[model samples]
Target chain A: MAEQVTRKPYVREVPRMLWFLRHPRYMRYMAREFSCLFIGAYTLMLVVGLKRLAEGPDAWAGFLAALGSPGAIVFHLFALAFSAYHSITWFRLTPKAMPVQIGDTFVADRVISGAHYAGWALVSLVVLWLAGAF
Target chain B: MATSNKPIVWGPFAAGGTLTAFLTPVLILLTLLAGLGHAPDLLAYDALRAFAAHGIVKLGLVVVIFLSLWSAAHRLRITCYDLGLRADTLVATLVYAVAIAGTVAAAAYLLRLNPV
Candidate 1:
C-alpha cells in the first residue's frame, strides 16, 4: 500500500452522457444497455394486462381497447424496433459474460451467441403456436 | 473498507438480462400484433384468460416477471450511476423496490387468476 499524501490531487470528470460517444463500441454497448428500459416498460405493461384480467372481463376489455389506441400502437412499433436492437446486442454479449466449456474445449463465442438466437426462435415459435398465431 | 452486497442483486440481474434478451423482442411483436387488431383468437380475452388460468403458466409467469424486473432494476441502477447520479443507495433502493413490488404484484394477480 502506498503512503497517504496530504497534497491535493488532480482529478478529471467524465461527461456522463457523452462519455460513450468517444468510442463506437462504448456507444453500441450503451445503446444495448439502454434497451433495458423499454424491456422493463413492456413487462410493466404485461403486469397491467394481468391486473386487468384479474379485475374481470370488463376491465380486460378496457385494457384491450386502450391497447388499440393510435398512441399505443406507435409506441409499440418503436418499442418493438428498439427492443429488437437490444435483443440482438444482448445475444452477442451473452457469450462473453457467460461462457461455455465442453470436454476440455471452450465453445466459440459466435456459436454461443447463435444458440441464444436459436433459443429465442424456438421459444417464440412455441409461444406463437400455443397462442394460435399461426 | 465497507462491504457491498451488490453480488446478491447482480445474480438475478444477470439471469434477468438473459431472459429479457430472449423474450423481449417476441413480446414486443406480440403486443404489436394485438395492438394492430390482428391478435389471434387464442389471445382474445376469453381464450387468453383461460390460458393464463393454468397454475403452471402462472408459476412460469411469476418467475419470468420476477427475474426480468430485477434485471431491469439493476440495469437502470447502473445506468443511473453512470449517468452521474451519485446517490447509489437511494437509487438502488428505489429501483429495486419497484422491481420487487412489480414482482409481488404480478405474483398476486397471477395467483388470483382462477382456473377455468
Candidate 2:
C-alpha cells in the first residue's frame, strides 16, 4: 500500500476583511460622525461660557475676552467650517430619518435640504438683527 | 461563513434601556427641583449639585452617564465600521471600554465637587 500524504490546513496570512468603509453607506455614516466633532466642541464652548457665568462678573468678562482672542478666533473659524459641514450632512439625512409621503407622492430629498438651508438663513438674519450687527 | 439576513442588534441598547428605565424617575425629580427656580434658596447651591448629593440621585446619574456613554460609544463604533475605518472587534471593544471608563470618572468627579 502507498503511504498516505499528509495535508496541512491552509491559513491565510491576511484575514478575510470586511470592506465596509469603502461602501457608500459607510461614507455617509463617517461624514455624520465627523460632523459630531463640531457639535461636541460647540457644546463644550457653551458649557465653558456657562461655567464662567456661574463664577462671577469678572470670570464672565474674562470668558468673553478669551473668546475674542486670536486663538479663539481661529478655533471659531474652524468650528464654523465643521458646523457648515455638519449642517449640510444633518439636513441631508433628515429625509432618510423622516420620510415624507403626501398621498403616495414622495417628497424629494433636495426639498428637505433646501428647506433647512432657508430656515438657517432666516435664523441667521434674526440673530444678526438681535445682536445689532445688521 | 454564511451571513444571516436578520439585522444584528447591539448590546448597549439593552443595557442602556434598563439603565434609562431606572434613571427616568431621577431625571424627573431633578427637573422638578430645577423648575422650582430657587435653587440657591432651597439648596444653597446649584440644583444639579443638590441632586447629586442625594444617594438615589447619584446612583441614577451614574447609571445614566455610563449607560448613555456606552450607547454612544457602541453607535460610534458602528459609525466607524460603516465608514470603512478600523472595524476590528478588538478596536470596537476598546472604544466602548474607554467610553465607559471616562463616563465613570466624570461621574465620580462631578459627585466629589462640593456645591457652593
Candidate 3:
C-alpha cells in the first residue's frame, strides 16, 4: 500500500487564454498557429466558389461579384498575408523535419530550405502562367 | 502500449503543409487579384469553368482542397490545445468533421462540373 502524503505541492498556473501573451516568441508561435484559421477559411471560400461554379454562369458571376466587395477583398488580403507567413514558417521548419543524408554527411539546412524556396518559385511561376498571367 | 492512429492524421498534415507552403500563397494572391477586379483572363468564369471541367484539374482541385482543409483542421486542433482547451476529443471531432465535410463538398461540386 502506498502511503498518502499530506504535502501539497506548489503549483504555478499559467493563464488559460492569455499565456502566449507573456513572451514575444510565444506570441510569434501563436500567430503562426493562428494562421491556420485564415488558411482554413480561405479553403472554405474555394469550396464555396466551387459550389457556385457548379450552379451555372449566373451563380458563378454572382460569386465573383461578391468577392469584389470591400469586405471580401480585405479578407482575401489577410488570408494572403497569413498563408504567406505559414509558408515561410513551414519552409524554415522543413530542414528540421526532414534531414537528407548523403554518404557519411547530412545535407546542410540551407540546402534543403533553399530547395524548397526554389520549388516554391517554380510552382508560383507555373501557376501564374497557367492562370494566364505572363 | 496500444498503437495510435496519429500517423494517419500526421501524414496529411505534413503533406498538406508542404503543399500549402509551396502553393497556397500564390493561390491566395490570385484570389486577391480576383477580388480586386484584376483577375487574369484564364480566371474568368468561362475559362475557369472549362479548366475545372477537365479530369486532371478536377482531381488536382479536390486533392488541394482536401489536404489543405485537413491540415488546417489538425493544426487548429493543436492550437486549441495550446490555448488551454484541454477537451481534445471534442475539439478534434469538431475540427475533423469540418475538414471531412469540406472535402466531401468539394468533391461533390467538382463531380458536378463534368466536361462540357
Task: DockQ for every model, please.
Answer: 0.69, 0.06, 0.84
**Candidate 3 chain B weakest ten by summed lDDT:** B34-43
Best by lDDT: 3
Candidate 1 lDDT over B26-107, as tens digits, reads 7777777877888867668888888889989899898889888899888888988877887999998999999989989998
Which residue pairs in model 2 clash with each other? Answer: A21-B83, A21-B84, A26-B82
Lowest-scoring 10 consecutive residues by lDDT in candidate 1 chain A? Answer: A9-18
CAPRI level of candidate 3: high
Which stretches in model 2 have alpha-carbon errors above 4 Å?
A1-31, B1-116
What TM-score is obtained by chain A of candidate 3?
0.90
What is residue A79's positional error in candidate 3, in angstroms? 0.8
Candidate 2 lDDT tens digits, A1-134: 59877998898553223443557985665665554344334434444444554455577557656665676656655655554554566566667867889998889989976786677566655534442332
Error of 2 at B56 (Å): 27
- What are the TM-scores, per candidate, against the unseen true structure? 0.89, 0.48, 0.94
List, residue by residue over A48-108, the lDDT tens digit for candidate 1. 9899999988998898888889998988887777778877887888878889999999899
* Pairwise DockQ winner, candidates 2 and 3: 3
Using alpha carbons, what is the TM-score of model 2? 0.48
| lDDT over C-alpha atoms for residue A101 of model 3 | 95
